[model samples]
Structure formats: structure tokens, C-alpha cells
Target: MSAAHVPVLLAEVVDALQPRAGETIVDGTFGAGGYSRALLAAGSSIIAFDRDPGAAQFAQGLPADRFRLLERRFSELDAVTGPGAVDGVVLDIGVSSMQLDQAERGFSFMRDGPLDMRMAADGPTAADLVNAAEPAEIARILYVYGEERESRRIARAIARRREEQPFTRTLELAEFIEKTLGGRRGAKVHPATRSFQAIRIAVNEELAELEAGLVAAESALKVGGRLCVVTFHSLEDRIVKTFLAVRAGKTPGGSRHAPPVETTAAPSFQLSFNGARTASAAELAANPRARSAKLRAAVRADAPVWRAAA
Candidate 1:
């Protein structure tokens, strides 16, 4: 793992969790075991999960009794570790710096390598999605996940290029996007950045996993237990924000003219703070990835879990 791959929101996450001796906390991301290490230092038992097998290799030599690592995604958390049993659950959602730093992982357009961007290293790669997805479907992924404005144009370019020669390498895809979108001249951000983000998210099913994981986390947490999520992009942050708001019953009030309805399901969570928190300027200076991170936390309310609307 690269030394530069420091976990974002480390201090804030640890402080929010407030782990205590004998308490069991779940580090749902387990990227580089940064948060897990801190929790262990605080004398809390940790159950850490990472879908990436590479991360498990790095976790060797860690105290086995105090910390246990699971080779699973956070969405499968409830299935593996029974529901409503944890004291707290922390998820650092989206791609990890470890995956992005290694060019072989093919997450970064800045470095040239194979166009593979599988977090697990054994799943469908970015190349597969880009080469096979329909133009409309590709456009939708870019728009929704990457928030790319020129999604249609970019998708069209990708479709056109792949017909002549399918992209197999990172720079091949990146250079195609750059040339088609107009390379570096006065570009605030790289032209290929959003396109790469869209493909990676699609390849990993990141948004879907996040949604499922949020629901699973809510169900898995005990009443009064906390769920803390750190999101680095707007799409993920928006989902986290809305999920917490809905659970806290913070929805806009109904008009007085409307008939009052009896409550069938109790609100399951209360916001730990008024709004999301960001890292300190000092932290951002040390880790640039921390700049975009937003932390949202909520404590489970003393109520039964509410099923999704049918």
C-alpha cells in the first residue's frame, strides 16, 4: 500500500464512533485498516470487512482476538453478522485510495495500465462495461454516477471508438476521452475524469451497493447504536443524506388540511448532529482526498425497523 493512501476523515470518524472497552464496532470498509487500527487502539473489539482480497493480505499479523476481518462487502453485513447486534458501524463509502494508487488496479486515468477497475480483482472490469454497454445505458451511468454533463456525447464517442478497436488499456480509454472532449486546454479538471468515474462506479455497482448497505446498516444496528458514513462524492453523499433524513423523520411537514395518519412504523434514527461535517483544513492539506469528504452520522432510535415501501 502506498504511504500517501491515508484514510480520509480519520480523526472525525474515530471521535464520532466514541469506541469504548468491551464494545464491538464494525469497520465496514476496512481499507488499509486505518479506522480499525484506531478502534483497536481504543480497546474496542472490531469486526472489519473488505471485499478486496488484497486488503486481507495487508491485514496479516494484526491481533486476531481483538480484530477479525471478513472478506465481504458491507451490503452482505447483516447476513454474515446477525442484525441489530453491533454497538456502532462505520462505512467509508466508494473507491479506496489503495485501489486508485496502484495503476495496475486501473482506477486512475493519471497512470497507464489495463482498464480493469475491479475492487475485488475478480469481477467484471471497466473495460467490459465500456465495450459492451449500450450508448444510452453508458450515458445514464455517466450522468448519474459521474454527474457528467456531456454524457451523451462521451458515450457516443466511446461507442464509436470501441467498434473500430475495443479499449484494453487505461491510457487508451483516457486518451480517447481526452481528445474527444477537448484535452487539457483551460480544463479545470481532466476531461477523462468523469468518464472514468462513471465506468468504475458501474463496474463496481457502487451506488447500488451503497443503497443496499445503508439499509443493511440500519437493520443491523441496535437501537441507540450509531451509523457513520463518509462519502467523497455528491452522488454517494446525497444518498446518505436522504437516507438519514428519512430515517430521522426529518421530512417536510404535511399541511394542516391533510388528515393525520397513525404511525405504523417508528422513526429508526436520529441525526447525531444538525448537518454533515467536513475535515479540518489541516487534514485536507495532509490528504487532498479529504477535501471532498462529507461525514454524516445518526443514532438508531428506540423503535422497530421500518421496511421499505412496497
Candidate 2:
């Protein structure tokens, strides 16, 4: 299948990965097959995974001999392949541009459609959460996931409105939110942006999936194998940063009140770059969606995957 959206930080990810001939790489979030296509062209075999079943249609025309698409979440990577089997793994976190553009997906508040925002076909949709979740739970989701400031007020508004009539359409909910939040008041973005994002993330459990998927990648990569992650927002980026920092043994430990505690654990990975890389001005100008993109990469160490301290 052809790419419906351009992959952000493509060259940077490729440079970090350096996929070689005969090596196997995992495209853990194979939206539109952009990275998979590029890696395939570089002569590497790929095992690509995507939670969205709709993404499989885009898997067409790929090299069948070198490519295999798994219609499952990337969190299943370690389960699907034995430890240290793949040379590299890459995850592009958050909703894709194509998903956002498709009104039927309910990822965007710009267009009117059903309030379904599931990555995979089978799941409780955004509509289910908004209509059924408790107000406090809804507030927590908005606050924690979307970082929305007026989450409580928004949740209350939704609770009251859904009592009158359950939200079934995207624009219907978006307009109600706009009215509750004072009609955007000439804001740069739509009033329902945060609500949409929060609902979508909650529906898909995206943040949890990302955390699991990163650990899975750590387990799946062979020694010296690389991991490249492209995150669109701070929530996803923060998880990636913390995971790598702790795994690389770069995180500062011990409190000012206590002496340093030592551990025998070995570093699982080494940072490939000093910090996350952002999109180039040229690329951002060409594709506005690439503006929020950030890329971070690392090389795996020979040490076994670290488990949480008991």
C-alpha cells in the first residue's frame, strides 16, 4: 500500500537505525508504511505492526518476501518474536495524519462523523466513554491525557449534556464543547481539540500501549540494535525519555538526604543523540502536521532487559 501520510523525521530515523541488507527491523507503528517502505528499499526485512486494521489496506504493494504486517498493537512485539531477534525497532506514537483526515475515524473535530476513535476495529469507542464514563473519570482522562486545564468543568458539561442526549456525532460534541468553553473566543485551535485528543487517547489506551511497546522493543532488539521513536506530543515523549533514561543508567539517583544506593543492574541501551530532534524548518513548511514531531534514538546494549525493582 501507498503511504497516506509522510513519515516524520524519516532520514534521521534511517540514519540512527542504519538498516543493513539481510537484517530484520520492526516498524512497530506501521502507519502508511512510510518507514517500512524506506527500510525495505534499504534492503532490510521488516516485521511491521499496527493496531489499526484499516492500516492493512496500506500494506499492499510492499515487498512480500521482505515484509510482514501484523495487525496488532506494537505492545505485542516481544510476544510475537523471540528476544534479541530484530536488528532495530521504530515506533511513531499518537494518531496518524491519515486517521485525522478521515472524518469517519472521528480523530478530528474539523469534520462531522460518528464519534468512534478506535485504533483497532474492536474496542469501546470514544462515544462509549463520553456517554458512559463517570464525570470524575472523564475529568481525569482529560486532565492526565490531554493536559486540559478545565477538565472538571468540561466533564461536568458533558455529563449534563449527555443526560439530555447522548453524543453520537463528532461535530455535535465539538459544537457543544465550543459553546460550553465560550465558542473558542478566537483561539488558535478549536475548543474541542483537547477533548477530542483526550477521548481518543483514552479509547485506545495509547499512553499505556506506548510504555509497553517501548519495553517490548527493548526486549526485541538484539545487542547493538537501534531504537528510534517519533512522538508527536509531550505525554508520549515524556514516557520515551524516562524509559531510555532509566534503561541507559543516565537517570540521577539517591536523594540529597540519603547516600547513593548502588545496584548491579547493567545499562540496557545507550543514547544515540544528546536530545530529541525536531522537524526541520523546510519539512515543517512542507507538512504542517510535522511541526510537533520529535525523534529520539538509542542503541541496545548486551545486558538483558531490566525488570522493575521488586
Q: Lowest-lDDT window of 10 residues in candidate 1?
A: 252-261
| TM-score list, all predictions | 0.93, 0.95
**Candidate maximizing lDDT:** 2
Global lDDT of each model?
0.85, 0.89
| Best-fitting candidate, scored by TM-score | 2
lDDT of 1: 0.85
> How do the residues 241-305 of candidate 2 rate in per-residue lDDT, one tens digit apiece?
87787788877463442234445678999999888998888887887888889999999998978
Q: List the residue pairs that clash in candidate 2.
A: 1-59, 1-60
Give the TM-score comparing model 1 with the true structure, all chains together. Answer: 0.93
* lDDT measured at residue 224 in model 1 versus the true structure, 0 to 100: 83
Q: How do the residues 93-163 of candidate 1 rate in per-residue lDDT, one tens digit apiece?
A: 88888788789999999999999999885888899999999999999999877889999999999999899
Question: How many clashes show up in model 1?
Answer: 1
